[model samples]
Target: MFCSLVFCSLCFWHLLVFGNSDTVKTVSVSVTDGDTITLQNNDSQLQDNYLLSWTFERPESRIAEINKGARNFLIHDGVPDGRFRDRLKLDNQTGSLTIMNTRTTDSGLYEMTIKSKKDDTYRFTVAVYAYLIAPVISSDSSRCFSPLSPCSLVCSSVNLGHATLSWYKGISVLSSISVSDLSNTLSLPLEVEYQDKNTYSCVLNNPISNKTTHLNTTQFCHTCAVDSSEGHANCCDSVEAVLRLVVTALMGVAAATAMFF
Candidate 1:
């Protein structure tokens, strides 16, 4: 009988450490700022006498709890630095926790514990990224010597968080640059012919969202017709001279017709 009790104690200790590993689950979630995210308990339903608790960052910092036996559902968001105050919601049925208006500071580890006849734990690693901004496209006219010269264009954006800035020609990427700083200015350069016909775009993106800006070559790079006599003259000047001559001829014709009438 004594040997049997010792064997039972050893078995219980082994199960306590090893068996509990299977009951724990971990998940990784990514979300954008000002968005809401829910961490599920993985429990389809809760019993009448179950206890559920949630902690953030560390185990000792309890942020939420639910006690069905005591008929209590409490959110302790005010305890841990008040970062989650008025932003946390708890589901009474599934014991899932939801965070509203999530910010970048909320990116961290969260844990959930459920106790009844069995113990179940859930871990979530949440990453909240800032909203992305559209990139701006500009041309460097100093690099252009003639109308046929390649235009040097730059794509730039203010990085609110970790993001990648890329230039794409159609669907293929031409070049890219990445920044991990919280606040920075990122720029990517691309050169193309003034008359080249191709779809181009600049994109700024993060793990959660992306923004794009289409390139309009005609708006930035002005095409001028070659004047053989004057070497190199702006086409706009020739067009304006023709328009003035036409206006002068039309005025003379109108004056002659008025005199005849």
Candidate 2:
């Protein structure tokens, strides 16, 4: 009788260890660094027959447990571990997990399990993206005088991951440059009229970060003639605009001399 009891206990332990191994399923998750992330089941709703629980296996810890009945009780008072005690949130109704102010250390797979006729399980592969930095905008000219020239407003920055640099005129993007294979730095120059009246700016960005610098259009074409059709086009032809202004002035002086003679 003693041997039979020991054999039965051994069988029960083996079932607990290997019976539910196939129930662990994997899901994918991506979240911006320093942002809040929630892990939940999208397909199934909580029903009367099953109970819900969550486990974060990468940290080797039990995250949460919930009972489904009217007298629903939260095991471990809803906090299952020390690392997540301050920032973890458990939904009383759906048993979803929410992590606030997430960091790189928090990136890992999370699992949600339900005890029903068949044990249902879901896994999530969580990833936290790095934050981005703003770029600096520089000018490649000592002074932009009446003689219009092709001056470049250079925008550049160094950071991890991917980034894009762009030049804008008002609300519209004049041009954009992108770099993905680069480990940390990007730079681009947007050539434009070297006058104060032609407003422009440079912007830098990544998936999680954005930065911008505005051009002092007033410093570019300090003196400009308004073109009725294109707003500022007649004022922006670098060398041509200056040549036209000089020729027009000289012609006016010559005409005045002839009238006096």
lDDT of each: 0.79, 0.63
| Clash pairs (backbone) in predicted model 2 | 27-123, 195-220, 195-221, 196-217, 196-218, 196-219, 196-220, 196-221
TM-score per candidate, chains pooled: 0.72, 0.48
Best by lDDT: 1
lDDT of 1 at 236: 46
Model 2 regions more than 4 Å off = 1-31, 42-93, 104-109, 123-134, 140-148, 158-160, 169-175, 179-183, 195-198, 207-211, 218-261
lDDT of 2 by residue, 161-241 (tens): 556888888889878888764465777777666443556778887665677877765543344456788765444445666
lDDT by residue for model 1 (1-261), tens:
011111122222122233743476666677788887777754467878988999999999999999999999999989589999999889899888889888988999998889888887777778888888799999755332244457778999885688999999999999999988877889899888866899999999998789999999877776655678889544543445567689999999999999989
Q: For candidate 1, which ten residues in a row score worst on lDDT?
A: 1-10
Model 1: per-residue Cα lDDT at residue 142: 36
Superposed Cα deviation of residue 235, candidate 1 (Å): 11
lDDT of 1 at 166: 96
